[model samples]
Target: MPTQLLSAEQSTALGTKPHYAILDGLRGVAALMVVVFHLCETHATSHLDQVINHGYLAVDFFFLLSGFVIGYAYDDRWNGMTLKEFFRIRLIRLQPLVVLGMLIGAALFYFQASPAFPAIGQVPVWKLLLVLAIGCTLLPVPLSMDIRGWHEMHPLDGPGWSLFYEYIANLLYALGVRKFSKTALAALVVLAGAALIHFAVTSKGGDVVGGWSLEPTQLRVGFSRMMYPFFAGLLLSRVATLSRVKNAFLWCSLLLVLVLAFPRVGGAEHLWLNGLYDSLSIVVLFPLVVWLGASGHIARPGTARLCKFFGDISYPIYITHYPLIYTYTAWVSATRPTWQQALPVALLTFVTAVALAYACLKLYDEPVRKWLRRKLPVMQ
Candidate 1:
C-alpha cells in the first residue's frame, strides 16, 4: 500500500495538487459512521441510533465523491480513454468483493435453512435459486419470487441498491453522450425532475412504491433519485473548478437547495429531523470533507489507527456487515430474548465485521484491483 499520501509540500514539489487525503479521510469517517449506525440499530441503542441515523446520507456523500474523484482521476483521460477500458477498470474494482459478500450471505442464508442446523430445515428451492441468481449476476431486481421477497430479505445489504446506481452513473459517463453540453444539461434536468417527482410522491404521503415495495415504478423511481445527485455532483465539479467564486457559489447554492428541499422529501417522522443532517451531509459536507481528507489531517497524532484501519476496510464492511448484523440480531433475539441482552452480541458483530472486512481487502479487493490495473492499462 502507498504510505502517507502526498502532503501539500510534496504536491507542490511535484508541481500539482494530488488527490486530497482529507476527502479519503472523509470517506473513512463516512464508512465508520455507517458501521456505528448499523451496530446501533442492531443493539437498539437509542442514543447512538439517533446520532448515527444520518449515516445513510453517507451514500450521497459517496456518490458525490465518486463524481469528484472520477472527474479528478480521469480528467486527463476524457479524450483518450475508451468506454471499454473505463468499464473494465470499474468492474474489476467493484465486482469481486461484492460477489464475495453476496456469496457469504447466501451461504449463511442456506445454513440457516439447512437440515443439519435443525433451526432451519432447508429453504425452498425457489428461494435458493433467487439468491443464487441475484448474487451471481450482481444485479438486483425487485423480484417477487424470493423467500423474504425484496422487501424483507435485503439479500445481502439493503444499501447494495446504491451500487447499482453508482454503476449506472459510471456507464452513462462512459457513453460519451454526456459530453455534449446541451445534451448533458437536458439529461441532467430530466433526471433531476424525475427525482423531484419521486421525492414528492414519497414525501407527500402518497403511496410511491420502490425496490422494497417490489413495484417496478417504485424501483425505477428509486434508481432515478440516485442518478440525480450524481449528476448534480458532476455539474458542480465542472463549474466549481473554473473559479473560486463559482466554487463558493456552487456550494452555497447546494446548501440553499438542501434547506428548501429535504423537509419536503423525507417523509418518515423518524427521518424528519435526521433528514436535514443527511441531506447537508452530501450537499455541504462532501466539499468540506474532501477538503479535509486532502489536507493530511486524517493521520494526525490523535487519530486512532484502528479507525483508519476500519476506513480501509469500510467498503467491504459495508457490503458484508449487514447480513452478519442481521443474523447476529436474529440469533440474539432467539437465544437471549431481550434487546439489552443482545448488546454484547452486537459488539461481537462489530468486531467480526471489521475482521472480515480486513480479510476481504487483503484476500480479494487489493489483488483484484492490481490485476485490473495491469490488464486494463488505462493510465499509460
Candidate 2:
C-alpha cells in the first residue's frame, strides 16, 4: 500500500507521506468478519436471523475505503501516469488472485455436491470451463448457464461480483470521476446516498445484500450500494484532514467490529431503522474510521507485526475463502447439522479458509505479481 500522494494534513503543506497502516489491518478485520459471517450464514434459517448480523455492511465499508485509497494513492500522480499504466498496475496487484480464486472455485465445484447443489456433479466440464472463462474476465455468466440454483453472476465464486463493481469504480474514476470538482463529487455522493437510502428502506429485509446477480434490480442494488461510499471516500481523501489520535487502531477496530457485529434492528415492523443504521454507518461512520486509522500509528513491535501479517493476507483470505464456503454451505444445506454437530465442520472450514488464503498469497499471488512487475518494467 505504498503511495506517492500528498500526506493528509490541515496545513496543506508538504511533509513526509505515510500509508494508512492501521486501515490495512482494519480491512483485514472486516475480511475476517466476512469469513465468519458467511460461515454463520450457512446455519441461519433466513437472512433476517443470521448471526454476525451486519457483515454485509463490510462491503460498503470496503467501497468507502477503496475510494479514499484510490484518491490518496493515485490522484496527484496521474500527472505522470497514463490510465493504461494505472490499469496495468491495478491488474498486476489484483488480477492474479482473481484468477486463483476462480481456479480454486472451479476445482472445488464438483466436490460441493449436496442437496442444495445436487446438479454440481452432473454439470458438464464444458459448462464449468465456460464459467471459468467468463469469471476470469470478471463477466457474469448468463442465467441460462447458471449451474447453481442461485443466480449469482459468478456461481463458482460468489465474491467476484464485488470485484466486478470494484473494477467499475476504478474505470469510472479513471474516465471521468477523477476529474470532478469537489462540489460535483459531493453531489454525486449525495445522489448515491439517496439511492442507497431508497433501496434500503424499500427492501423487505431492510439490508443491502442483493448485489451478486446481474438483473436490473440487482444491478440497481449493486450500483446504489457502491455509489455513495466510493465517491464519499474519494471526497474524504481530498478534503479531510488527519490529526494525531490516541489508540486509533484499537478504537477504530472496535468501532468497525461493533457496527458489523451489531444485531439487525427493525426486523419487520420498522424496516427503516435498519436501513437508517446501514446508511449512517456507511455515510458517517466509515469515513471517521478511515480518518481515525489514518491518524494512528503502530508503536508496539509485536502488534505491528501482527497487523502486518493479517493485512498481508487480508485480500487473499477474502477472495479465496468463499469457495470453501460454498462446500461448507452445501454440506450444511444437505445435513441440516445442529450447531453441536456442525461445530467441528465449522471449525475445519474456518481453519481451511485461513490456510488456503495464506497459501494462495505466498505460493500464487506474490509470485504472479512479481512476474508481472518484472515483465512490465514500465509500470515499475
Candidate 3:
C-alpha cells in the first residue's frame, strides 16, 4: 500500500521507492480469480472441462511478481543488508499468515469431512496437531502425514505448498541468484523458460498446473513452474525501461482476466495445446502485464484507493482462501449440486474469504509485523 516494500522504519533508513500501484491491483485481480478458479474447479470432472480453465496460472504470475518485487526492494540493498536480515523481513511478512491459515484449516478440518476428503474423519487429534505444528513452520510433511488424503504436503492447508516453494525461491535468491550478473541472469532465465516449456507441453496432464506435493515428479513440476517467471521477473526489473501507459491498470486487468478465464485451448485429444497456452501465458503474457502495470499511473483518488485496498489484502486472501474452498469442495462432492443450486453458496464462500482475509490483515498480520519490526534489530 505504501509502494515501498519496506516497513516505515526501514523505508526511512533507506530512501523510499515508487510503488507499483497497478501491479498491486493486478495481483488482487489474480487472487480473486484464483478463488473463483478453485470454486469452479470442484464442479469440473477434469482440467478439460474446468471453468476458469487457466486459473492455476495465477501461481506463476505470483512468482513473477515476487521476483520483480524482491529485485526492486532488495537488489540494491545487499551492500548493507545481511542474508539473515533479509530472511527475517520475509518471514515477518509471510509467516504469520501461514500460521493462521493452517490454524484455520485445522479448525475447519473435521467439518470438511465428506466423500471428497475421506480421511478427515479418521485423522486423530494428535496427528492433526502434529500437522498443524509442521504447517506453522511452512515445512512440507511427508505422504504418511497427509491426514486429508489429498497428498498435499500441508494437508491441513493445501495452498501452503506454494508458500513452501516461495520460501525456496527466496532462499535461492538470497544465497546466490541475487549476485548473478545481468548476462548470467538472462542465461538462467532462458534455461528456466525452456524447462517450463518442456514440462508443460510434454506432461500427460498438460499445462503447468501442479507443484503441490513433495514427490520427485511433483518436485519437477514445482521447480519448472517457479524458475522461469520468477527470474524473468527479476531480469525484467533489471532491464526494463518505463514509459507511461494510459489506463494501464484497466487494460492489464482486462487482459489478465481474459487469459486466465479463457477456455481450455485443446480438449482431451490435444493436452499439449493447453500446455502450450500455459507456457505462453507465463513466458510471455504475464511479464507483459506486469510491465504495463508498472508503467501505468493512477490518475484519480478513487482508483488509487482501489489499487491500495486490493494490494493490501491480496496476499492475505490468497493464503487464507483455500481452506474455505476445501469445505466448498467437500459440499459439492457430497451433494453433486448443479451450478444454479450451488451458485449462492459459492458466492457466499467468496465473500467470506474476502472478509476473512481482510480481518486477518488488520487484526493479526499488521500488528504482528509492526511488533516484529520494533523488536527485531534486523528490521530496525
Per-model TM-score versus the true fold: 0.73, 0.94, 0.97
lDDT of 3 by residue, 1-380 (tens): 22322223234335656667888888899999999999999999999899999999999999998898888888998988898999988887889899999999999999999999898888899999999999999999998898988778988888888889899999999999999999999999999999999999999898887888888899999999889999999999999997888888899999999999999988889999988999999999999999998888878777777887788888899999989999999999899899999999999999999999999999998898889877875633
**lDDT at 277 for candidate 2?**
87
Give lDDT tens digits, candidate 2, residues 1-380: 23112212201212344566677788889999999999998888786788999998999998998898888877887777798888887787778888889999999998889987877878899989999999988888888878876899999888998989999999999999999999999899888888888888788778788899988889988998888888899999999987777777789999999999999888778887898888888888998998888777667766666667677778899899999999998889888889899989999999899898889988988888778767874332
Best by lDDT: 3
In model 2, the clashing pairs are none
> For residue 110, what is the lDDT in candidate 2?
89
On TM-score, the candidate that comes out on top is: 3
Candidate 1 ranges with C-alpha deviation above 4 Å: 1-17, 43-51, 111-122, 125-130, 150-154, 176-214, 241-281, 291-311, 372-378
Residue 230, candidate 3: Cα error in Å is 0.7
Task: Report the C-alpha displacement of residue 287, candidate 1, in angstroms.
Answer: 4.2
C-alpha RMSD by candidate, in order: 6.9, 3.8, 2.0
Name the lDDT value of residue 315 in candidate 3.
Answer: 89
Give the worst 10-residue stretch by lDDT in candidate 3.
Answer: 1-10
Model 2 misses residue 26 by how many Å? 0.4
Clashing pairs in 1: 20-294, 21-293, 21-294, 22-292, 22-293, 22-294, 23-293, 23-294, 113-122, 209-218
